[model samples]
Target: MISDPDGTVLALFAAFCRIGGCIMVLPGFSSARISLQIRILLAVAVSMAMLPVLWDQIYPQVTGKGHSYLLLVTFETVIGVVFGLITRYYVLGLQFAGTVLTMMIGFNAPPTADVLEDTAENQLTNMISFAGLLILFLMDFHHVVFSALVDSYTSMPIGAKFDPQNVLITLTNTLSQTFFIMLRLASPYILYGLLFNIAVGFVNKLAPAIPIYFISTPYLIAGGMFLVYFGIAAMLKLFADGFGPILRGL
Candidate 1:
């Protein structure tokens, strides 16, 4: 039923190069828990579904003679990877916040497997990262990511030359913006930790014989937990809200 099935297949492969590459690094999809074969199949399925919609744009490009299809594949994959990393960095920023929060709150639980990845990290950090990722899933951040990938064809198009300068600038901006967002979210706990430690130090100074540091451990954990109980909802809300603006800005 199809005319030029070969061209169609080539176009599909081209689409896959980008979509599959993006999925390989995108947060939820890229989790180590997701088998690589499953991700590959999902990418192929998505590429097929998108093929009809992108047919006109991709078909012409793929059908052209004398163009190195291999080169195109490499470039498209790079572009996809770059796009994926942009979203990935935002999520990684949450992990940074988690680490900072865990350290500040003194939740020095033994290291455990990360819920999202196979790597070991402090238990509290793992918990916070998982919770933040779960919230992002509930909000359908993946939908936004794929939508933006679709639009990227218009802005970046197929076969656009890779710009290291732009890539560097984008990454720098993302890091800076994400850092500020993380800082703001964790600022309350940071202040709480600082003041709590300072006060404990003062008490220890006043009563040199008393083991104030030992005495303060339970209170430190309790106060941090209380702050988290009150502030976690807002923290995640702010974090999820920032994702859109950051992606759009890039």
Candidate 2:
């Protein structure tokens, strides 16, 4: 059991380079609220658990590799980062959609701390972003990420030459897909705001003497809020449903 202690350690670290790299930028796990120590520990724990399953593949590639081991670490980390970014970018798409929704609905309240992160965001943006993330967690999205990570070892074996072009292509595709999905989610709000603003513009022209801008704002916001109340469930359901197919497609 103790014959190849050094090799075991090396293999474990190799595994960590990938898993830890993914967790380093993963959405919920990488939030500023999560302490650094906890992230490291979780990465190490997962790496250890994975090493046993991947020992035949990882242990062989790492053992006796000497100077080349350093290069392996770098490539492994990069691949993991690509995997993590895929999911991170998708979640960020939701945040972008939230911002658009807030602006469209005229809910331009003072920005406050984001519920999931330290950044300041409009209250409506914060609510939509947080709600979307919560729904993903409830749907066990992390499990999907982990499953993909496991499959990656087979598709992208350790010590394989890193392909930056392929990585770029994957990320570009993810962003493209994420943008379309988020656009669909926010489309209703977009239309509401567009139509509402046009009507308000005409009313302002008709009552040029009155402060129509001030008068119409409350109605604009109220109508937007009503739309959100009635539509949020369907919006999040579509968001959650889309996550699986997108990640699996990758």
Candidate 3:
């Protein structure tokens, strides 16, 4: 039996619309700093590539109910956005951690206009965020993202009812996890900073005549830089080990 060309195109386009809009806002890929032309190209590339795999699964489920189709497409877009948001949380975790670290490190740069969100993250954020992305790449975590996109069609069916409560719960849980992971990942620096501050404070108290401010600033700066430098392997290792589990959780 031959399918109606219009119906097939509609189904195909509906699926494409969701996937295209998703990759546009998807973390790592989503950046206004990147040219619109490039984003469109990426959207098209991902949309076309995903269509074949997802179409058979999603097409049958699409009822093609006149204007109801727009509602369905909107739901699809929401699902896509939710998926991107959930998956993007890990990147946001790094940014959050970087933001806190920037404050500690005295790098109070404004969040860029092209940033993914209104995070008050600083210039060191650029470093930490880039480092996080780089670590994700090195750990091959994008494979998990691609696999999750394919898996999402089956997990979240077309025209399925979404629970707003569950969405809120998921977001809350994700933010909590992000903050925890940020502290965990940067524990080395946090530990160093804490101990250094305590010790320096004591030394100043014991030696009231000495300007520990002059003495301690260079030590903390040098020590913090040293720890951050030596800590790359640990950070990347954490990324490698945790990313698969995080993707699976998402």
Candidate 4:
């Protein structure tokens, strides 16, 4: 019954190019553990739901541009990916912090399959990343992401020319901010590891024949575990709170 069904279809496809691209890299939604079909379906569902809300911004752009459809699709996907990666990179900061924490705290666990990605990761790293991501989910980070995507139409409209230099700057700034925030989150462990190692080193120097470093390994891990027990809740809380402001600022 719709008079311009072709136009509507084109608009929907254009919407998918952005929403689908965002979901393709979204943290919880885009996990390797999720089946490809499920991700695709989720993206499609989200795009369909978003179509009406974003119709004014998206529909007119694609309705009559048959020859430029490919170009529009490509740019829209790139814009979505850029936005998705903003959050993705922030989540990845937890992994980076975890890696540092494990090394500093002397927690040596064998590498295992990462819960989020297919790569192998230290058990401690996996635990931290999983916990952080789980907490973010509990905090409804995805809703915030979708909201931001909706707002992006105003900030980064469809068909906007892709500027590689600006894109590079944005990515670099996201990474820089992510790194600083991660450093702050993991600083306690870094300091703990440093002071503990320094004291252990002095002990080893005093008792060179006793393999004191090996002797202290158990204590080091025990202390780190204790710290995690008390601090993880606060750490994840900070991470979740920071996501919205930092991403919106970017």
Go through the candidates in order and give the clash count of each. 0, 0, 0, 0
Question: Candidate order by lDDT, highest to lowest?
Answer: 2, 4, 1, 3
TM-scores of the candidates are 0.95, 0.97, 0.84, 0.95
Please, what are the lDDT tens digits per residue for candidate 4 over residues 165-218? Answer: 887888888898889989999999999999999999999889899999878999
Candidate 3 residues 35-125, lDDT tens each? 7788778766777677777777766766557877788888777766666776678787777676666555434456664354444445566
Cα lDDT computed for each candidate against the true fold: 0.86, 0.91, 0.70, 0.88
Select the stronger candidate by lDDT from 3 and 4: 4
Clashing pairs in 3: none
**C-alpha RMSD by candidate, in order:** 1.4, 1.0, 3.1, 1.4
User: Considering summed lDDT, which 10 consecutive residues are worst modelled in model 2?
Assistant: 241-250
Q: Which candidate number has the best TM-score?
A: 2
Candidate 2 per-residue lDDT over residues 1-250, each given as its tens digit: 5689999999999999999999999999999889999999999999998888999999999998989999999999999999899989989999999899999999999999887787898888788877888888898888888888989999999998888999999999999999999999999999999999999899989989999989899999999999999999999899898797679654
Clashes of 3: 0
lDDT of predicted model 2: 0.91
Give the candidate order by descending TM-score.
2, 1, 4, 3
